[model samples]
Target: MALPTVPHLSQDGIAFSAVKNRPAYAIASVDSALLLASLLQQEGAMRVTDVAARLGVSVSTAHRLLGMLVYRDFAEQLPDRRYAAGPVLRRGPVQQASVARLREVALPHLRGLVEAVGETANVMVLAGPDVRFVATVESDQVLRVGDRTGRTLPAHLSSGGKAVLATLDDERLAAVVASLDAAVAVRLERELRTVRRRGVAVNDQETEAGLTAVGVAVPPSGGVTGAALSVAAPSARYSRDRLPVWKEALAEAAGGIARDLGDG
Candidate 1:
């Protein structure tokens, strides 16, 4: 059976031509990820051959794709080497067990970051093309930014989103760029390259004027989705030259959170 092609704009707000006829432009990795996700969500645990047969791909391809899913925490390797829906997916969409766990584990570190940098600290997770702010700790300073917990913003516009984006592999990145406008794709690709080189992502008032944020991706754990720890401060107080502590704090906090998730 042929999959239906649905019209949608890419992250860069560029329209994709219908995939039904022009299959050449279709991103195989993205399609495979979607197919595998659907299978795992509906069937729970599965073996390598199961995914291979369902996606009609080679066993090696299935294994490679599944590994990526595991890296992003959308799937996990079971004791027998079979794959199962990961904690993030099993917890369901929206605020639930996994998200709650992430929030609980991250809040203390976020607070510590606030104390360290005198800026607002946040934990953000990728939700499709956006980064959702699941938890935040506000700075004590009167001039600090407002609490942004529960807010959602475009992934490319925020530090956390860019950090997560930087972790995507080439095929996945190609899929994303394919959906964006020519101009936006070029710009976002350039930025992601920079993020990869630096091991961190920065938002210099990109999401909102006068606000600056620096973020680092949290390494994947058993049940954690790709996420980032970020510190947002007023640009006046966010001087990169003087705020090296913020980078150090985010790295420490991200490491702690990843460790906790691994232990669970």
Candidate 2:
């Protein structure tokens, strides 16, 4: 019997068509990813041949596709080398620009975190070695970290940047920090090491005196989804040092968003 096909449903074709057409890494040929995705819907798991038969592609081609899936962690190979959904993924639509998708995936979590911390919560992504605040929800508190809806800050100077960089290997991390002055780069590397250990990044008067922020990197799947969840509070409100609360909240929120993007 023939396996069923993966539906070609476009959740927001008008908006996401451009992105869907472009492969995650800008590499050509998405036939395999689509085929694998189709196979996933038809069955809980699949082997290379199972996909090859349905897509009418050669088994060798299927093998190559499966290997790509393994590289990206979009599908996992069990001991038997059978594939399942690699991990959490951003799904449903593709026409959306990266920024739009980031907002959709992150806004709900950011809002919840803001409500929890009673301060502004933000979604920040690294843009050309700088951390850009793409989305934000201001806190209900009388004081806030700052009004930074679409502002960019030095990745070395912000909590979100540290969190994201901590997840990178030394070489990649160094490239980002190297762009800064020596003192700034050294301080950031030291802090990034601490972030890797503690699983959260803190910018206590580092970004700006009298402003404290906490964040955790959104375990990235590829690049567009690579961002961090952060909470910003006035030094006064954070005076008593609500570090633990924000740390837990940022991690939880980032995790939730990661799941939505298929990174969990």
Candidate 3:
């Protein structure tokens, strides 16, 4: 049977006809496996049944293929029994190096920020349209925000993400907005303009109902593009009057990280 094909389009929206035809000697099983991997990587979590339906294969065959992908470290079964792209499939050495270096150099600054603001502080990097928390330092206060390491949130909704978004050039910013809903894209663009003017971004119960955060972009340096520093606190503890203090502390921490990256 011929493999199912989707039309490939260039940046200018021109279709590429050459890629539509399956090769003469294409192996069905190999093609199915590769296609399944692509689905997992692009669509995020999927159940076994969803995989079977998407691949036009039997449930047993889908299970076996997913098993092989798991064995090869290309996919992992989530706690909810859904499959997602695994470590191997998510690896990007250059991006990883930047994330790692940024996390390392920002730790001390994060700690300092936490001390100054008495709130949780985090370092995050933009991964596509999402922001991934790389490191976090929690405040000692009992009612403070918790560490957010390894958490991923929509870049447009996150304080750190919006701060980073404000730093992006027009073309890059447009690409990111294009991936979002029209209304959301318009709202985000307006917010980014404010972030740019103030040099700080605020997340007022956006990501979480009772949490508030303020962030500043860590200026790009040493091959790192979109990285930010944020301090989070409980909404009860947040107020407009505190913005100046929080913004100052976050800017100081972000600047320290940028300076450290420059020296390294």
Candidate 4:
């Protein structure tokens, strides 16, 4: 008997035909597993019950689907006992290697910055309109800013984001900030000019209360901006007089990474 064709949604949310000629490969269990994986990827960490609720399935079914995902390395149980997207699901094949290279080239420079500034140093890249912390080296101090590796934050609100934003051409910058309100857009346009003038960006407890940071954009020798390097500390410890020192350390680290990546 011929199976009836059914509409399916692709990863890009486009509707497509399924089940007809492909009925042999369209097992319900496999389809459910793929949907579960996609949900986990889109929603970040999710509990079994949460997944079940979202998928309109029984908890047992959600558990089984998650098990399959874990077995295939598409998802993992976080320390909090929730499931989050795993390595294979997060990056494309080429992006995985590119990110590895970025971390390798930035680690030494990040450590050096931490040692020089006595603050947490991070290597961040702009992922679309967001700033993502890819690697971090913490200062030895017991009360320093916490590690932010694998975290994403708004680009306009972070020093690293501002530093990277300063490197964009006017047209690109406008497009990236298009979602901002009129007041914020106007303010950010002015701030970018200042970042260009000072060659650094400062987040003075703007992103989070009681934290401050200094950032510098990594400029490749090829004349293109690559990433941003930043050093962060407690607001109490990050006094105005200390900005220059942190700025110098971050700039040096950024320059070193850029050079290593052939962007110096």
Candidates' C-alpha lDDT: 0.75, 0.66, 0.79, 0.73
Candidate 4 lDDT over residue span 1-264, tens digit each: 221221333333322121112243478777677666655553367899988986678999999899889989999998999998777778621133345467778899998998898878888777778776677787776456655655667788789899989999878888888989899988988998999999999988676656678898887443324478888876777788888888888878877777787732
Please list the residue runs of candidate 2 whose C-alpha ends up more than 4 Å from where it truly belongs after superposition: 1-96, 239-241
User: Which of candidates 3 and 4 reaches a greater TM-score?
Assistant: 3
Best first by TM-score, ranked: 3, 4, 1, 2
* lDDT ranking, high to low: 3, 1, 4, 2
What shift in Å separates residue 75 of candidate 4 from its native position after superposition? 5.6
Q: What is the per-residue lDDT of model 3 for residues 1-264, given as tens digits with 9 covering 90 to 100?
A: 221331222233322121133355768898788777655654467899998987789999999999999999999999999998888877532265676688779999998998898888999888888887777887876555655665568889999999999999999888789999999999999999999999899998787666788988998888777889988887788999999999999888888888899999
Q: After superposition, how far is residue 156 of candidate 1 from its true place, in Å?
A: 0.9
Question: What local lDDT does model 3 show for residue 110?
Answer: 91
Residue pairs in candidate 1 whose N, alpha carbon or C atoms collide under 3 angstroms = none
Instruction: List model 2 lDDT by residue over 38-102, tens digit each.
Output: 34532346788877885678999888887887788777777887776666433422222555567
- Please give the TM-score that candidate 3 achieves against the real structure: 0.68
lDDT of 1 by residue, 128-174 (tens): 67777777787766555555555667788789989998998888667
- Prediction 3 global C-alpha lDDT: 0.79
Error of 4 at 165 (Å): 0.4
| lDDT for residue 142 in candidate 3, whole number 0-100 | 52
How close is every model to the real structure, measured as TM-score? 0.63, 0.60, 0.68, 0.66
| C-alpha root-mean-square deviation, each candidate | 14.9, 15.1, 15.7, 16.0
Which has the better TM-score: candidate 1, or candidate 2?
Answer: 1
